[model samples]
Target: MRSMEVDMIRTLETDKAPKPLSAYAQGIEIPPGHRVVHVSGQVGVTLDGQIPADPARQHELAWENALAVLAAAGMDHTHIVDAHCYITERSHLGIYRATRDRFLKGHRPAATLLIVAGLADERLVVEVDLVAAAGAAGPAT
Candidate 1:
């Protein structure tokens, strides 16, 4: 595997593996001493418990809420090493990617997208789960 370290996280890619089709890495190597954060899947529900009917809005809110969790952990989008996004409809892929890409801000992490039959709530059309890490390696590990 070939990798380059960005913000103490290593992004993995190999000629033997197929290149990622979108803004994501083929793999991510988390170095030692990095504090790993497993964030729960954030759905479309607003802080006030509002669930937007628009799929695009749901996608946006899901990402927003997930990022908020990262912020609480003292991390940001750049610290993310992996992510999985679930969407209710195949038709929502475009908006999903747009919102994801915007929030990621050119930071590509290992990622996957799943089209699911439905979420916990019918109105919750989108959900985002993330794995993030930061901190220097070595003794800290």
Candidate 2:
């Protein structure tokens, strides 16, 4: 029997737009034979079970939580292809964008932002979910 090797993933960064903060790349490219990973919406609650009162802090925590989930799936920020962000208040958009830009750095993945009435927890001001893809060594199932 013969073995097969999977190609590595690639990232795309361009000078066309503002530079990313440093946490992520401007874009990511997943080859044809890759596996996709989906991370559920993550709230602002910390590992210690504490949710910050400030919206900005909440936004940061949410992104951190989402990143952690992606890491658990054997992927990183560079593998992210899309993200969805939810904010409880319109006033928090600026803070949310700043936090997101910082966390994502230069990774310009497909994204969506929505202002919702509330989250599963009333104290949570922000929630974020992500999708990532990585090369798979095995044949497509």
Candidate 1 lDDT over 1-141, as tens digits, reads 788887667888999989898999999988777789899999988899999888888888899999998888878898888999999899888998899999999999999999999989887889899998887542232
lDDT of 2 by residue, 20-139 (tens): 553444555677878898999999887999988877878888899999988877777766787888998999877987898888776667677889998998888888999888767632
Q: Residue 135: error of model 1 in Å? A: 1.1
List per-candidate RMSD values in Å: 2.6, 7.3
C-alpha TM-score for every candidate: 0.93, 0.75
Q: Which candidate leads the pack in TM-score?
A: 1
What C-alpha lDDT do the candidate models reach, one value each?
Answer: 0.88, 0.77
TM value for model 1 = 0.93
> Which pairs clash in model 2?
20-105, 24-107, 25-106, 25-107, 26-106, 26-108
